[model samples]
Target: MTEETHLNPTQPVNQQIYRILRRDIVHCLIPPGTPLSEKEVSLRFDVSRQPVREAFIKLAENGLIQIRPQRGSYVNKISLNQVRSGGFVREAIERAVVRRAAILVTDAQLYQLEQNLNQQRTAIDRHQLNDFFQLDDDFHQILCDIAQCRLAWETIENIKAAMDRVRFMSLDHVTPHEMLLEQHWAIFRALEKHDEQLADETMHQHLAEISASVLLIRQENRDWFTEEQ
Candidate 1:
């Protein structure tokens, strides 16, 4: 595993470590089934073992790692069931959110969506994959907010961790970011026109791509997935 580049002294050490490890795991930098050592991670980050242990606990809670009593902690392989379950929840909530957003969105909120799309284009042009991914998330989040369903967005966040890992793996391999951007545009248009049916259909199509990508990725990286999947 690569050492974290820098740590902010002001922030909580465990949270920082958790975020770094989470990003690496999600991006497949630390491949599935690789053992993690508290000692090594602590030394690498120049922090104490306590923070590393705390970080591991958080990672395990997020389904990114498996902690064995005596064996060791290892990055958990992707579960196909979790991916499907997450996708189902995401689609159900987002479809409804978009439908309501189509009816409730205002001109200012529409402009915000436009600005987000412009930033996404800039991120793509600059080859900033991470930035593009964040923007993509923000786009859907904004729609949820516009629909006055902040609670729904919170639920989606909790359930989408598995789908997020799949998305990270899909980037630059199974799907192009531009294609995702286009889908966002379609959804944006639907909201602009206040077409609930169109919004619902577009949201469904957009999220369905994740399932297709998961199938392709599983074939390519079999070891990264669980046997039970």
Candidate 2:
């Protein structure tokens, strides 16, 4: 993965830091539960400890990291709560989004989605995990564009960040990968017919399994997930 480029000054420093770090963490470029030292980050970024500290504080606010009083910062363990909440929110938005996309989606857009799906197939065949994951992200974002609610796509993105690590971890599972491709086909068909209800239902069904998917990860990497229920 490329280094996260921090955005310019319209936003707060901590916010920029949080966003950059969040992306890296979600992508598993930085391993989960890995310790993060503010001093180290400060030196790396050529910033003060305060900004780095502030950044960690913001990540803490987002539950993306944990800080101990004397000990250094560390990536937080995988959160079942983030998975549950993100899945819930995605279901609600995608229900509306897929339905709307069905009505508004043009043939061109549908073709584009098909092309995107084709790349996903290629990624699978080539065993290119990064490319597959990137295509998967593009597919969903493009669907949200079809719905014409760009901000809804942004909301979907923020929610995705929380569940992404779990996704990255389990994405190697062949059955789910094949199942996801099939689900995309179903969604594409429902959208093509402008069948809002069918599209909505299909999208919900797609997101609703996220919790179960994470549970599979929980079983394999008990250390990565939360200890609580």
Model 1, span 110-139: residue lDDT tens: 999999999999999999998998899899
| Candidate 1 to truth, TM | 0.90
Candidate 2 has its poorest 10 consecutive residues by lDDT at: 1-10
| Candidate with the greatest TM-score versus the true structure | 1
Residue-wise lDDT of candidate 2 within 1-229, one digit each (tens)? 3355445767776667776787788777887668998777766666677877888887776667888898878888778887788788888887888888999999999999999999989988888887887788899899888888889988877666667888788777823677888888899999889998899888887776677788778888887777432
Runs of candidate 1 exceeding 4 Å displacement:
1-5, 8-12, 227-229
Q: List the global CA lDDT of all models.
A: 0.89, 0.80
TM-score of each: 0.90, 0.82
Q: How many residue pairs clash in each candidate?
A: 0, 0
Tally clashes: model 1. 0
